[model samples]
Target: MNITIYDVAREAGVSMATVSRVVNGNPNVKPVTRKKVLEVIDRLGYRPNAVARGLASKKTTTVGVIIPDISNIFYAELARGIEDIATMYKYNIILSNSDQNAEKEIHLIHTMLGKQVDGLVFMGGQISQEHIEEFEHSSVPVVLASAIEPTGKIPSVNIDYRQAAADAVAMLTDAGHTDIAFVASPLKDTINQHVLSGYYEALEAAGIEKKDELVIEGDYTYDSGIEAWSRLQELSSPPTAVFVNNDEMAVGVIHGAQDNGVHIPDELEVISFDSSRLALMVRPQLTSVVQPLYDIGAVAMRLLTKYMNKEKVETPIVVLPHHIEKRGSTK
Candidate 1:
């Protein structure tokens, strides 16, 4: 019988992600979990190197990855997953940052194509027509992580941004916060737009009138989040709770409220998206929507491998699950 990671995980009562982290030497896994997974691996004789074992005679190719910013913890986590899988598949990664700029993204695509990369993995906020054109013209397979391609023409891996955002807002609404505010990333980005719609959807469902001033635009930075919070404070009817787009911005909002002598989850409840490591690092740790960032990247790379090898693919679009992680920041 073939031993697989899934079998190992099932035996150990852990997630496949935990097994992957243990195999990949990711430090985030709890010590007990790591020990358990390692024990299961030893007992089951399971190896995660099945791809390499099968492709012993395969040539080592390259996969070009275009990211928005590596400095962001969210992107950094995703990058780690991509690199690990690429390494397992004996594919070298040529990484570049596009900074979520359209022209730069387009140029990177052409440049990666010029290098004859075997595949491409892209992460960005919006998928413009130019991007679609480039993807259509590219000879190599392309996949997106944490990006939504409206046309469904491109293969991608991501979570349901809309439903996650709705859940965040609804959580606050359930806590009896009628005056909830939102610190959003740029609405121009499709992901943010989806989140925006979900925010309204939640408000509409609760019969709470959406206040215009409560929706503040942010640049997905700590400073932007602080500024958004500051603007909300200046309002005649300040928000009792705020939903931020990402962890960094959420931390900024928390600190901003603290600086003004507002106690978290007391005077100002908060919820944010992307429960990255930064979420736990902050004081009064954030209650956030946990996005399986690494999983998204890992799955996207795996899918690209399928295309590169001309294997059968069942789905071109994949939506991973996301859920709320309640913590000190929310009631």
Candidate 2:
């Protein structure tokens, strides 16, 4: 059902390079050989890959998209933005999931590069030194979307995660809840670490000592939020308010509390980040830090296009704005 250059070459008893040369309109091939290749191509219904056709012009017109998990709503929306912009610029997308694994991330980078994509848009958590080295070595341009590279060496798009976390914690404290808890993502993550730091800063500002029992690490999942709440319920003095890392986990925290017959806001107040659509999908709604997820993805793609097209980019690191979405989740 499909044809390739190799099929044409084998059918015509010609080399692959010869087929390439003929397809590219290179006059170096003999007239007879060119005509034979053309006939084979036509008879085999072999349509040249558009990217291959544009290679002579030094453009593949295709971009690789590396995301942590396409199943995640946050990344899915971001991917949509990237794909939409890429389509506008007439670029095809090649998507792959790294599953937030470092080794897999590196492997995907190499794989995408091997595909000869003109550029890449990457989204992940905790970009490592190895990632930095790989991006530095890439022949094609790479832009990070809603991801962080601690060294600030890579071109990326994100919001001020630390400040956002601090603001959310302050709001919880301002409501007269001294026993505030922090539901965090993977502790190793740079953004999570910053968010945790902001939480501590908020506590310190109010002259509250950090409580080791109040901090729980979650995996940015509803189940984790539920687990965090379960753990909090065991504490001698459970928190009256909590700062959750994401909406999914925040929802879990709420349900976790309700499952145990604990009333929300009346007994526990919850605030979350990423003001993703999930924030609004739950009952009583979620109060969260609104992130420009689509804009981050769209802007990252545009920045990558600029690099791929050899256009000038004044700033490599782009930090989008973030705001808190006040809702029923918090008092």
Candidate 3:
């Protein structure tokens, strides 16, 4: 078992705060008490730096990063930013993919914490009550990147997902497209739910009634986008435009339409979230909501450092800015 400051404090019959002062050479501690704490720390082979390294000029601690899917371009970009910032801070990161599985995610949390990571940065689609509880009870600070916990108890960084989705759908509405379709991801996660809510809100604002047939759910994959197109064509009156939840699926929708001899931006307008590289790779480049993936990860890692250092954070929950990037996919 890895010994921690808590162990040293318990053995010394002192508070963790008192043990901290002794470790940091604070003059406020009584000399006899400090000597006793030091003895306990030495006997227990406790390394204070692992728990409290805020005063150190050079940090060599490791932080854990939990990503839903590192293979996805969206999460890959976010991870890149996190890695760069971790390098700059002289800290290493242990990255794990949960595959969006609740049990696996919970397991990873316990395993990483057992390793005594100085902090944690998590990115996932769903944040369950159990996940929040684990994070709250964690010995190390936890920071969320592009994830939401409804209780707002955990520190996190994200853009206004609802507003961003609304903005994307509104663009299609502004183009006088009333017969619009939404290619959405699974609504199990709050993020996708926010996107779906925005889509409906935009239609309502444009005085268009929500059509049950016009909405199709995708699995955030290119293949799913293709499959969604097949479903939409089965409708008697196919939508004239589509708002996709992510760029990969949007590209699939575009290709699927083109394969059926449909002219993009002329026959069907398309807009998607996550202006990732996939957006620009297509023939008629995708118009997308700029989510600032890298920035979100970088900011999240920076925020984690603040908590690890016990620094005062003015805003524990950070909301970044987002905008629409119009391209050939949208008229």
Candidate 4:
């Protein structure tokens, strides 16, 4: 037989209202009463009816998370963190992939809203002004995870890409590598631009002349990485070191270099951002910048919960810290 709130209240010798307060995690009840009610609840194996509870509170207790690509290890780990926290808070998550398309993002947002999600978490390349305007009219709260727009009006959780990239480049330059190449995704995206800018700044600071021929653009894909590596090798003078934007492409670059009879960390050193599991799977292993992807997702969910509860959050925009993981990929 399923246990009910009435059973918990009767067992605890408290009124139904007191039991309700304890179950809802309300702090208004006395500690003794709360403890007693919790004991009764645990002993009886009582489970709160989420649907009824939501109706009574006028909240769905569901958060919608929209990520650019679910298959990507970065987003996958982030979703795991978000789901873990949501479960801890007795909330469910509705997850979707947007493919980093603005139109798809917009459509997913509307779909999630229509589903009556109490809050939203979005992760992508760049959220446009039009998207922000549309969200402003949304009744539910929305938070950005691992994404940032220039306006800085919306709440977001991300690391300083520019600084992280700069640090990576600086590490190579410090290792006596003057011929360095930056392999990045499309610079049209805001996040990619920040990383590229960091690379440029680091090179300029190191007094290393920027070579247009050395910079290669990839779509953050393994195939793109291979193609970019081929193109870079075809150049009259190939770079001694390469900094890739992501681990997937970095792996591709490594393989491409090997196929071309290049030795890692000797003939060609490679490093990338996003310290994913793939970093360790490689032969020499990839040295990468570790972005707190899970923390970003968890914190974004927490902030969205606060917003849903009408609570004041200290900071709307959260910049998480990142660090480089030194490995065999770079000298």
Candidate 5:
């Protein structure tokens, strides 16, 4: 026979409602009572019938998570935070990867919605009009994690990319490096566009004219960073300092420069975005912009929960704080 909530409640000398509250992670129950109820649950091996509960509550207690690349450390960290928060709320997640492809993303959205997920947490580089239409029409609440919608009509959690990029470039400028280069992500990405804007804004503020050649487009990969450095070397006068879009590419640039006997910081100051573990693994650690990846995911999921539960939300569009982490790569 399957152990039921009644058996656990009776064993713990509490009402079924108390057991239900404890099982559902409700905070209103007293600590001692919660502990006793949990112990009874563990001792009795009481398992809540999720299907029956869903039928009664009209909730599947599941959420959909769409990410760009799960293998990438950046997205992996964000997914970790999202999963943790979801577990606390007793919600299971159906995660899918879109590989930053627009068509695949739309398909995944439709597939997840078909499953009747209570909510969705989406992370991607670009949000086109078609994407916005799908999200707007979604029966369930949708939240963008570390992604942006130009119209600000959709709820999202992210740091200020433009400001963060400008700050990183400003650091290089403050060091008196007039010819600073930028290794950027795909230009089509809205986040990359903001970063590029910041790069130009910082240069303009420093009384330095923008050079089209200095802004090298990258695919946000280590190989692309290496290729970017090679292309920079061919320039008439290469930049003295470089700001890369991500840690992987930043590492590639550093290695490429080192392979050619160029000293870091002293000879070629380098700073990159995304202060992930990869920053410290390199010879000369990367000076990078610290984006709170996990917090962005956690907050996004939490925001989705608020919407799912119909809770009052004062701020739907959340922008987390960002800062530069000084390391050996910069002077």
Candidate 6:
């Protein structure tokens, strides 16, 4: 009652080796042979035994993806892209959340490696030297997706955060907003530092004196954004426009301002990064930068696959493009 490779081969009038090649997705098989073998396999309801095949070939044909938070729309969309591409390549994905903790991330890496994943796609706020060292010694291929490690040795796919942030600020300045504020998470992270630097650079270019009072830090959460707005409002002269590091915080800022009787765009303009779905969900849709998070994840997975196959990759670092999507939040 159970069907196997032998049944498929016998039905197709082909040798077992030829059936094996067809099942493994080999391109050398002639089209007619492939079609005939597939028809036989389908008719017999024979399925390839992935576990047995992996034991023989030492490859699981699976990818492990680790992200900081899947609740965030940005990361959720990114994971979708990775899954789509992995499915295309006949591979499966094992997804996990690291909560952006370095120790937890390292532990997850070891666990995934123990499971013998063919490759890994990692995304987090900060990657420590220990992580880099572990990855350097890893037998499997690893790629950073929307995350940057301190060491530039690992392959990565991301947009130019510094440039993207700078461009957003420049746009705000050109729109006649002289007084601006930069709201971000901790600057200890390298990516956050680059974004903040861009904000400062744009202000300098526009001849606007940088005000320390206007620079506030949030934890990239909606609650933290509310706190940041409260702190900014207490200042002697509040900023007319604010650049938030993420859409979650931007939503909080918008709501917080409205609660304090401040009108968006007319009284206070807000811009955030990562044009996630939440950007459109807000009452006054957030004007934000598009990070192309999905593309970053997909490309990183592709690069890891190439590395796993011992193929030459064209580039170690792939920088995707980003742009601003204007909406109701910004003038």
Scored by CA lDDT, what does every candidate get? 0.91, 0.89, 0.92, 0.89, 0.93, 0.89
RMSD of each: 13.1, 4.1, 7.4, 4.8, 5.0, 3.9
For model 5, residues 6-121, the per-residue Cα lDDT tens digits are: 88888999998888888778899999999999988888888887655665566789899999999998999999989999999989999999999999999999998877789999
- Give the TM-score comparing model 1 with the true structure, all chains together: 0.82
Kindly list the per-residue Cα lDDT of model 6 for residues 174-287, writing each as its tens digit.
Answer: 999888988897777778988999999999999999888888888889998988999989888888999999999999999999999999989999999999889999989999
TM-score of each: 0.82, 0.87, 0.83, 0.84, 0.86, 0.86
Query: Lowest summed lDDT over 10 consecutive residues: which window, candidate 5?
Result: 49-58
Once superposed on the true structure, which residue ranges of model 3 sit more than 4 Å away at CA?
Answer: 1-60
lDDT of 3 by residue, 1-331 (tens): 7898889989999998899888877899999999999999888898766534543523337899999999999999999999999999877899999999999999999988876788999988999999999999998899999999899999999999999999988888988999999999998988999999999999999999999999999999999999999999889999999999999999999999999999999999999999998898998999999999999999999999999888999999999999999999987
Candidate with maximal TM-score: 2
Number of clashes in every candidate structure?
A: 0, 0, 0, 0, 0, 0
Please give, for residues 1-331, the per-residue lDDT of candidate 4 as tens digits. Answer: 9888888888899998898788788899998888888988989999997656666677778889999899998889999889988998878998999998999999999999887789899898877888888677888888988887888888888999999999999999988889899999887788999999999999999999999888889988999989889999988888999999999999999999999999998888888999988899998999999998789889988888889888989999999999999999776
Clashes of 3: 0
Estimate the lDDT of model 2: 0.89
lDDT at position 141, candidate 6? 86
Clashing pairs in 2: none
Which residue ranges in model 4 land beyond 4 Å of their true spot? 1-56
How many Å off is the CA of 144 in candidate 6?
A: 0.4
* lDDT per residue (tens digit) for residues 1-331 in model 1: 8888789989999887788778877899999989989998999999676334224324337899999999999999999999999999988899999998999999999998776678999999999998998998888899999998789899999999999999999998998989999999999999999999999999999999988999999999999988998999999999999999999999999999999999998899999999999999998999999999999999999999999999999998999999999999987
Please state the error at residue 102 of candidate 1 in Å: 0.9
Itemize residue pairs with steric clashes in candidate 1: none
* Residue pairs of candidate 5 with colliding backbone atoms: none
Ranking by TM-score: 2, 6, 5, 4, 3, 1
